[model samples]
Target: MKILKNILKIFGILGILFFFWAAFVYFSFDKTEFLKTFQSRYSKVLYDRNGELLSVFLNQEDQWHIQAREIPQRLKIAVINYEDRNFYSHKGVDFLALLRALKNNIFLNQRTGASTISMQTIKLWDKKNRTYLNKLNEMIQSFALENHFTKEEILRLYLSNAPYGRNLVGFESAILFYFDKNPKNLTWAQAALLAVLPNQPGLIHLEKNKNLLLKKRDLLLKKLYDKKIIEKDIFELSLKEPLPHFKTHKNIAPHLALKLLSEDKKQVVSSIDKKLQIKFENKALEFAQGLKQKGIQNLAIILADTQTYKILAYVGSQDFYDLENLGQINGARAKRSEGSTLKPFLFALSIDEGLISPKSILLDVPTFFSNFNPQNANKKYYGLISAEEALQKSLNVPFVSLLQNYGYEKFFYKLKYFLDFKDEDYQKYGLSLILGTKELSLEDLTQLYLGLANYGQIADLSFLRDEPLKGLKTMFSKGSAYLTLQSMKNVQRFGLQNYDKTKIVSWKTGTSYGRKDALALGATPRYTLGVWVGNFNAQANANLYGVSIAGDLFFELLSLLDRLDLEFQMPQDLFNIKLDLMSKYRYDERLGGAYTYTLYPKEAKILRTSPFLKRIYEFQGKEVDSKDENFKDAKIQIKLDLPLNALDFLHQENLNFKSEKNIKILYPKQNLNILLARDFDKQKALVVKIANLKNEKVFWYLNQKLIYEGEATSRILDLKPKIYSLFIISESGESDEVRFEVKQ
Candidate 1:
């Protein structure tokens, strides 16, 4: 009895001494070093709006650090129940567990570790050689950490630094790497599997030791069940749950993910709808694959919300892994010619300025302004077409003429100021501006389309969740925008007249010169989409055209959106007015009159009546004296061979008409072909008449040769049976020529 008492007293004294030593060490330990000692390199994570994991950006060491708040409550309980149940009750070190470990090692001849969660965290903070002294040091620092932080903070520190298999550290990286999901959204079984990973990360290979991992996970789950931490049903279900299969971590939206990650290691929430993005990506891939069979290799798409201007889907390329197609390039951002895609905006501008209305007549015939002569896409002239028809047909000649009428300087200013076009772009592309000669990114073009959908308001796009909504600027008046959209709705694929009405898509298609790029831009009441299909290498493919390629893909994507039920509401500011068609027509009695009425919106300021309607007459005959009784009541019919505008100008000036004698070709006019082989020419001498002759000698030349000379009101020229270039010259140096083919 005395020996027992003596042994107990010595142990009591040693325990007191150890307690005091631990207190002294805890006080002396530098707690500030605990935070600075272990700097975890975290991987950047991108999440969707639903807190679903979209992608993960791995750090150099393949770790992801997360905050305590980000840790799910269920995961916290699973980890604590499996790793350290007494984590919260104990300060830092659990002496009871330590004694139990010592007893197992000594008497039971078994090895067990009793390191508390706090102590493990301290060890992770300052890795040291495994020795008695190092363990002592860890215990001391663990106590110090307990004094400095709460239980949750210490647990977070453990989780942030904990290592899982395959050199991946932290709960975020490990769970995401293994399960392909965010830790917060992990299933109970998944959480249990992750709880046992840190214990044997290096040794428990997923393939080689998967069963061992499963066994250990089941055991931990049973412990939870026995302790009532988890229900019996959950425990049984978890036991039957299969271990997570290893999944290759993918960086979806690689370009955008890398760009966001480059700035910081923190998790970023993007407004992108991952499901929609995946759908668009798949469609782009499928489309590109179909095109690749025809040597076309790349496609990009952008879908944005009309109201908020948020980009919901963005596919930079068909496939990021396709190196041969240069699929890594973000084709959505690359600048290329937009072809006739810009015509709608130009027409809108014209309509907004009240220069033209949707029904205004625009000449689509061959036109020349300065040295620039633009031809129609099909090289066919449609003499007279309405403004809406011109835009629907995408007639280049009409838009070029409209742009010229709008004045290049004003249009350039509007493009620069309203749409943010650069000055260099204006200088680079001149009259071809309406033809999309200047290059623009898909992002910019989509925003412009958004403006059309939003009653002419343009706003910048938002990608990040917390980004402030940009203010909208007026790009076009509500009336003009509505009219433009109305016109675009009429545009449809050839032979598919009712497709637009069925789809209700206000869309436009563009094929850049040489067929290097094909684009389709469309908008519903709620969404705007832009698609580009072409070779990323800028190789021209004749098979690729706007309506055939990009437009087809656009409609396919639209079907995925399931927004066909939506409809565009007409703006309240627009009015429908009916006017007399005759009031708008220009009437000229001469030169084979062709009359078409011009229409204008009710709000449009009337500039002037159609110049073609004004009439001016020029009569050529013997001079008539006003005093003569026969000429007093005479009404002379005259023919004017001048431009309509010139006649309008002459009428506006109220100029008096006087008959003058001159050497002029009355018969066989300019560009007229006279075939002598016919009996008509054989019976005629091809008489050439002159007005205001003033007794001047007239010289007639055939193919630059003087064939006849006479002073008369009319001269006749007879030539041998042959093709002749005939020229009639007056002594005043005025001359006219006609090519006549004479055949017997």
Candidate 2:
């Protein structure tokens, strides 16, 4: 009895001394150093919105040491049972296991190790020669670590730094490397296999020691089964499972991972939806196969939630491994010609300024703004097209004419607030700005469309899952945005026409000059997506038109995402207005023209009559009012709008237009093509006529030579087969000119 009391008292003294020692170690240990060591090296990991692994960036040593919050409970149990059964009961050192190991090494002449997971974690932090002194140092450090960190945290630190085969430094890395899955997905057999790896990582080579690894893994499973931690059927099934062989980890969302890594972020929880990103990548690759035959080597796509501005999927290129196509370039951030994608914004701005309503008439004829001449895509004018039709057709002449009316400098400043541009870019692009002479990125274009989708509210795009939607500013009025989107809802592109009408899509296509860049940007109520297709080298190809190439892929990707059964809510500020069918402006009953109802902005300027519309009556080749006595036999001819064109020309020429001209040309239309026949009977002389010329005398010049000076309403002159410039000047210094071609 006395010996038992002595033994118990001696152990009590040792236990009290050890407690003080641990307390001293915990207080004296360098916590900052441990923190630095913990944070110094970790494989940058990227996770999708749902916590699925996307990609892992290797550290400087080419090893994957990813930090994780927790491991699978099964894995933790397997590890605890196999490595340290008393892991929870002990402080940091298993004294009984150490004593048993000491007895075996000294008396049984056998080498044994009894380091707990905590001691092994210390060794992993600072690799030192295996000796008694070093082991003692690790034991002291483990005491500090155990006192400072929670049990769960200590377990995490152990697994995060544990070695599992080549270049894999964590259980998370091991699962991803060996099983090609996240740690949370580990099965019973897989968890046991990973748990046994850290003890003998060097012997984990399957070719030579696979049987040895199998035996150890089965033994761990047997222990788990006996302890009731796992069922008998699981142990049997685990024994039947084959060992995992070495295989390369597949990268997910590599381009976006690289982009995030460039900002020096080691871990990223991105806004990407894993399923959506995978679907987009597969579809983009499939879409690129067809484009490759046409020399379009690469393409990129960006899809985002319209309201949140969260980037859901991003494909920087069709294939990241295609070296021949320079597929590594991130096309989403690449700056390329904007093409006609910007025309919708111009349309929206035009509506906001009250310059034109959706159905308002705009001249699509050959237009000259100073030395710059803008032509339609088909190289043929529609005479006069409605503003909605002009936007839907992407007619360059009509948009350029509208921009001219809206003022180029004003549009430039407005766009510069969101799109990337300098002060000099406006002067450089001028009227061609809306025609796609400007350069922008797919990201920028996507953001612009997102703004249009979000009632003209522009905001910065979010890549991280938790990032707040920020930098919102109004780009256009709600009424204007609704009207613009309404105009774009039914574009006549190849695939868009057959789209489901209930879920309307508003989109625009753009082809840069020389077909160097093809782009499409659009928005539904739920999503705003942008697609860019072209060669990375900026090579031009005839097959690179936006509607055919980029737009095709855009619809394919759109179909991949689930469609929402929602409709765009119209802005309350929009109201119905009766517009004259002929003039396409605010209806005036005095004009005696048919009218139709169309939506227009309430705050927008209402044009009672189109600037291009004028009413006149003539009697006996002379101007006459309706009150004139000879009005019964008066001649009626609709004189087209030419005075407005002349005034616009004067503005472009910077000439004074203090007083408007009453005399307007009526014959030999601007940019006319006259075919003079070879036969004299068939050939007719070109006739020149004027309107509203009551008492005004005018001079007619052919190629700068005066041909006629009179107050007559009409004159005839024989012209040669050549390009001729005709000019007319009234007595008040107001002048108009027309360029025509005569062919024999």
Q: Which of the numbered candidates is closest to the native, going by highest lDDT?
A: 2
Which pairs of residues collide in model 2?
A: none
What digit string (tens of lDDT, one per residue) describes model 1 on residues 252-338? 666566556553335778778888888888888787778988889988898887878888877888988888878789888888878
Model 2: runs farther than 4 Å from truth?
Answer: 1-28, 262-264, 420-424, 495-503, 588-594, 603-609, 615-623, 626-744
TM-score for all models, in order of appearance: 0.75, 0.83
Q: Extract clashing residue pairs from model 1.
A: 586-613, 587-613, 660-692, 661-691, 661-692, 662-690, 662-691, 662-692
Best candidate per TM-score, number? 2
